[model samples]
Target: MKKNNSFTIRKLTLLIPGIVVAILTLQSCQEDETTELTRDEEIAITENATFSEDVSDEDIEIANSAEIEAGIQEPASRESSSEKCYATTWDAATRILTIDFGEGCVGPYGRQRRGKIIVSYGEEGNYYVADRTITFDNYFVNGNQITGELYVEKAVINEEGFYENNYTVNYTILFNGGTTFTLNGSRKREWIAGVLDDNFANNVFRITGSLTGISTRGISWSHQIVEPIIADFNCRSEGNFLYTQGIKEISYSNSRRKRTRTVDYGDGICDRSYTIAINNDLITITAE
Candidate 1:
């Protein structure tokens, strides 16, 4: 009888441990499910968020100003003279418009030295109405050769006869030091009134976008504009052209370290300087 009782005691001890393990396994699964659900909810929220709702008007204006200052909207022109030297050729067979930058040509802002742009459209009748893809070959920017492509999707012409193009840009820029950087982003471009004409001095434009880039030095940076950057050529007379307001995020060492900062263009004034704020620390940056 004592031996029988002893055997029963041993069996209960083993069963208790098994029960504890089973309970732990069940709890772990429930925790995993909860974590997965939370991740999914966060992703859903991000997917539903829109720039117009999340970004402020001031930031948008600043971003537009910066874009204009960056000369992104400026078409390719001759390096020597005011005469536009780029040739635009349309191919009916492929529904493509090729803009060739002849030798010694420069980009709109004089940022790019030489490159050709090929624009592909879905419909041939109206280039602005259809979805278009623009590819660049040997595009030079800031003495760096850039290659890759960008596309304009979901573009619409507003009732005021202005073109609103949503652009998705991806490009790889190879610097003179053989370092490469990849930039990808989505931006919106709108034409300012009276700037589309021959008055280059009076040209004003707006651009807003989020751009992310990865550098060959293992650094990654991202900029999210809170307001459209406004660019006014009139501001050039004041010695400032690019106005930028945005949030910049930087990560390095495989994201082991990270930093977030707010960038503010000079207070509604055209200046070649901006401020960056990280927490309570502020740094002012000026163009050289």
Candidate 2:
């Protein structure tokens, strides 16, 4: 009986190791099956996905704004023969309008500036002015300069005869100190009544826009014009735009650093100056 018990003990010891090995093998198979199932599920989702359906209204708005803003800087056309300052040429193949500012060109705010602006048009012909892509190569205003590209897309005249051209735009501005600003948003331009009739007195234009900009120094800003900026066609002044209710938010370092500001355009006083309030501190900035 003792011998029988010894044999049984040996058998039991051998069976225990086999059981453990089987259990480990089963666990490994189960883990592999789970991994395969997850991979298959991911593949199925990708195959069934449609990118267009996933696009939101906000995404569409941003894209449209980028396009319209790209074309906003077209030099105003003059009707007077003597005041025909910018020499214009058109390229039919590229649908590009080239405007050259001759020598002694004086722009708004008494700035002596000279440069060539190239404007490319889109295929759509619904509006009097088509969507355009404007490129400023070394374009200067006063002592400061603008050298970059802008895209104006989906520009359409307000059918209600408001003289407002609504569009979206995207732009990049490389400013001083190796600083660059990028913007994408929507804007509207309202030319003074009868301005298109070749009246220079009616050359004034108003701009209302909402824009989001990012700076090269990791800073970001978003602004919406509460009041339209009244800009003279002769580049005389730019102001009278308030963003009091629109709110301007600036952020840095992935939004960990942030500040909110509101713009006040001097109570209908067009001084070409505006005030920005940040944390209740008002800072004034004059247009250059």
TM-score of each: 0.59, 0.56
- The lDDT, on a scale of 0 to 1, for candidate 1 is 0.51
Quantify all predictions' global Cα lDDT against the true fold: 0.51, 0.46
Task: List residue ranges in candidate 1 displaced over 4 A.
Answer: 1-83, 157-162, 195-203, 233-240, 244-253, 278-282, 286-288
For each of the candidates, give the backbone clash count: 18, 18
For candidate 2, what is the lDDT?
A: 0.46
lDDT tens digits, residue span 248-274, model 2: 232222323334445554543444455
Give the Å error, residue 222, model 2.
1.5
Q: Runs in model 2 with CA error above 4 Å? A: 1-85, 102-104, 123-127, 143-145, 153-160, 192-194, 232-254
| Model 1: per-residue Cα lDDT over 161-265, one tens digit each | 766777776767676789666767787876664434544444455667787766455356566777666655555434453443333332222323344555555
